[model samples]
Target: MSAPRGWRPAELVADRFETASARTLRLRVADWPGHLPGQHIDVRLTAPDGYHAERSYSLAAPFDGEFVEITVQRVTDGEVSGYLVDGLPVGASIEIRGPVGGWFVWDPARPAPAVLVAGGSGIVPIAAMLRARRKAMADSPFRVVYVLRDPGSLFYRDELADEEIFLAYTRAAPPGDPRLPGRLTLEELREHTLPPGPEVTCYVCGPTGFVEATAAQLVSLGHAPGAVRTERFG
Candidate 1:
C-alpha cells in the first residue's frame, strides 16, 4: 500500500481510564475524514530534542464522531504505548498517519450477524464495531467473546454489559465465577460463538497466537475460512 497521507495533528481532547493498565485517548484530528471501525492509526510522538517514536493502534469505536478514541495498554519498556497510556496529557498534540484498513471493517449496510472475539487488549477494534452497530441501530445480531485475565481487565466493561457479549477470563476470576478460573475451552467457544454461515461474519483480534488459535477453532466449528477475519499484534 502507498504511504499514509500527511501526518495530521490530533489534539487530545479527552481521555478515560479503562483498566489499571490501559487508558483511552480521544483525539480531535483537524480536518478529519471519518473512518470505519477496525481501522488503525500510526501515532507519532516527538521529544524536545526532535527524536520521534511511533506506534500503530487500532481506532476504538465511537470514531464516527468528531474525535476518535484509541485505547493503549502500557507495555513494559514500550517506547510509545507506555508514554501514551500512562503519561500523555489531555489537550496535548500528537501526529497521526492513518485511518487505514479495509477488509476488517464492519459494514453496517450489509447487516450480517457479527461474531467478535478479542484477547486482552485486542478488544479495541472489536469495540469499534460494537459502537458502530449501536450508532446505526441496525437489527443484525452481534455477539462477543472477550478474553481477559479478570473482569477488571475488560475494556468497555460497563458499555458492553447490556449486549450479547461473553467474557472469557484466562487467569483469575471474580465473584461467582463461572468457568473455574481457566482459559476459554473449545466448549465455551462453541457455546458462545454463533453457528457458521454465509450470513455471519467473524472477526477475531488478539496476540498472534490467540488469533491463530481462535480462527482455527472457528474453522473447525464449520465457519468458512473466508468468513473469518483476523487482526493480530505481538
Candidate 2:
C-alpha cells in the first residue's frame, strides 16, 4: 500500500470499544500508504446536505496490510468523534488523508531508552510506538507511564498488560494498589520514569495541560529540552 495523495475512500472492516467512551476502528484503504509510529490521519465525514466534519486521530497500530486502525475518543459534543465512536457501522465508508506528522514519531533504530507518558486517550499513539518496537524486535529499553481518570478509562488494557507500564489513577485506584487516586505527581514521575539523562528520549502526549505539565516535570528533572518530544489534543 502506497500513501494516497489526497482523500481516499476507507471502508470500515472492524470496530471495537476499548473503553466506555472510546472505540477502535479498522478501515481498509486500498491506497493507504503505511504510516510511521506516532503519525496521525485526517478523517472526514460528509452529510447528505453537503455538511462536513473532520478530525485527526492517531494511528493505533503498526501497518501490516491495506488496513489502518484508529481509536477515537468521544468528546462531549464532538461531531466527528461522536459519530466515529458510536454511529459508524461496519462496512460504512469514510474519507481519510494521512500518515500526517513527522516530529512525534519513534524510530526503532534509535538506541536511546524511551519513556512514554500518556494521559487519557493519548495512549493511542504511544501504543503504536510500543507495537512498532515489538514488531521490529528492537532491544532498546522502553517504559510507559499512563494516567487516566479510572481503570475503566484505560485503553489497550489487555494488549499492554505485559509491557513495562505504570499506572496512575486520578479518580479511583484498583483494589490492592497502594497508590490513592490523584493527578500524576512529580514524585511518581521521578520514581516511575527513566532517570534524567541525555540518552533518554521522552514522548509525552495527552491534553494540552497534561503535556505541558509533564514535559515541565521532565525538564525540571534535568532531561535536555530537545530530547523531549510532545503531541497534544483536547
Candidate 3:
C-alpha cells in the first residue's frame, strides 16, 4: 500500500457503536486514502493556548478507500479520548496523520491459521482483521477470543455473535455460557481445542499485562515465538 498523504485535519461525521462503552468514529479525510488493517493514526488536539496532546488509535473498520473508522474507549484521564467523547461533535474538525505502523498488520496473501486474543478495547485491530479477511473471501483459519467485563461492555457485540467467535468474561457470566469464568489463563487456553500444527499464528492485543501474559503462555504451549504477534495499548 502507498503512504497516506501526510498528516492533515479531518472532520468527524458520526459516532455510534455495537455497544455503549465502545464507539466507532467516522472521519472524512480530505484525500480519503486507504490503509492496511491493524494500522493506526495519530490524533492531535490543541488547547486554547496551543498546548497540544496526541494519541495513536487503531483503525476498527476495513480500509474502504473513502473514509476511516476508529474505535475509541473513554478513558478516565485520557486527554484525547475524553475530548473525543465529550467535546468533539458531528462536524467537528480534528488533525490526524497516517496509516502508520506495520508490525501488527494481517496480509491475506500469507494466510495462516490465526488465533486472536483481545482484552477490553483491544479488539479494535482484530475487528479490522475480520473485515479484511471477509473482503478477501479468504478462508484463512481464524478464531477470536474476546475477554471483557461483560456483554454490556463487549466492543463489537453484534458482529461477534456469529458462531466463529468466543467470549471470556471476567466479571459477569453469560447465561449458560460454558467458557471459563475468570480472566484468561494459560490453563483455560490449553483446555480449548485448537487446530493442529506448529504453523498456526497467534495475534494478541489488549492491555500491556494481558498481552504479555498471553504471549508467554502461547510460547510455552509450543507455539513458535516468531508466530505469535502482539500489539499492546495502555
Candidate 4:
C-alpha cells in the first residue's frame, strides 16, 4: 500500500508529564490527514549538523482537527525517546508522517466487545481507542488491563478513573491497594478478562515478550487465535 505523504512540519504546541520519565506532546501538523485510533506517527528530528533521527510513536488520542497527541517514554540510551521526553522544547519543530497501520485498530461501528491488554507505554494507542469510542458514543463494551511497574507509573490516571480498567502493579503497590505486587498471572488474567467468545476481540500491546505471553494466555483461555491481535515495541 502507498505510504502517507512526505513528512510535514509539526510544532509542539503543548505538553504534559504523565510520569517523571514520560511526557505527552500535542503537535499541530500542517496538512494533517487525521488518523484512526491505534495508529502511529513517524517523527523526525534534525540537528544543526544535518543529522536526522526518527522514531515511531503511537497516537495517544483520537483525531482532533489538525492537532495530534503522542506519549513518549524516556528510554535509557535511546536516541529519539530521550530527546522527545526531555530535550525538545514546547515550541520546537519536528516532522511527522502517518496515521500508519490498518490492523490492530478499533472501528466504532463494530459492536464486538474489546479486550485491551497494555503493558507500560503500550497503553498509548489503547487509550486512543478508548477516547475514540467515547467520542463516537458507541455502545460497544471495552475492558482494559494495564500492567505497570507501580502506581507512580500509571498514565492518564485522571482520565481513566471512570473507565473499566484492571491495573496490575508489578514492582510496587500503593498503600491500601488490594492486589499484591507481582507480574500478571494467568489466574488473574482469567479473573479480569471476559470469557472467550465469537464476538470478542483481544488487542495486546507491549514489549515483544509481554505481547507473546499475553496472546498465548488468551488463546489458552479459548480465545480464537485470529481474534487476538497484538502490537509490540521495544
Residue pairs in steric clash, candidate 2?
A: 2-33, 3-33
* Tens digits of lDDT, candidate 2, 83-199: 999999999999999888888888765645889999999999999999989998888888899999988998998888988899999999889989899999998898898897767
When 1 and 3 are scored with lDDT, the better candidate is 1
RMSD of each: 1.8, 1.6, 1.9, 1.5
**What lDDT tens digits, residue by residue, belong to model 4 across residues 1-234?**
234888898999999999999999999987788788888989998888999999999999988889999999999999999999999999988899887898888876565688999999999999999999999998887889999999899999899998989999999998998999999999888988989988899999999999999999999999999999999996
Candidate 2 or 3, higher lDDT?
Answer: 2
Could you tell which candidate, 2 or 3, scores higher by TM-score? 2
Cα lDDT of model 1 by residue, 65-150, tens digit: 56878999999899899999878898888899887888888976666798899999999999888888888888888878999887
Global lDDT of each model?
Answer: 0.86, 0.90, 0.81, 0.91
lDDT of 3 by residue, 51-131 (tens): 989999999887876688998888888888878876788998888888887778887666667888888888999999888
Ranking by lDDT: 4, 2, 1, 3
- Clash pairs (backbone) in predicted model 3: none
Error of 3 at 200 (Å): 2.6
- Who wins the lDDT comparison? 4
TM-score of 3: 0.91
Candidate 3 segments whose C-alpha is farther than 4 A from its true place: 191-199
TM-score of each model, paired residue for residue? 0.95, 0.96, 0.91, 0.96
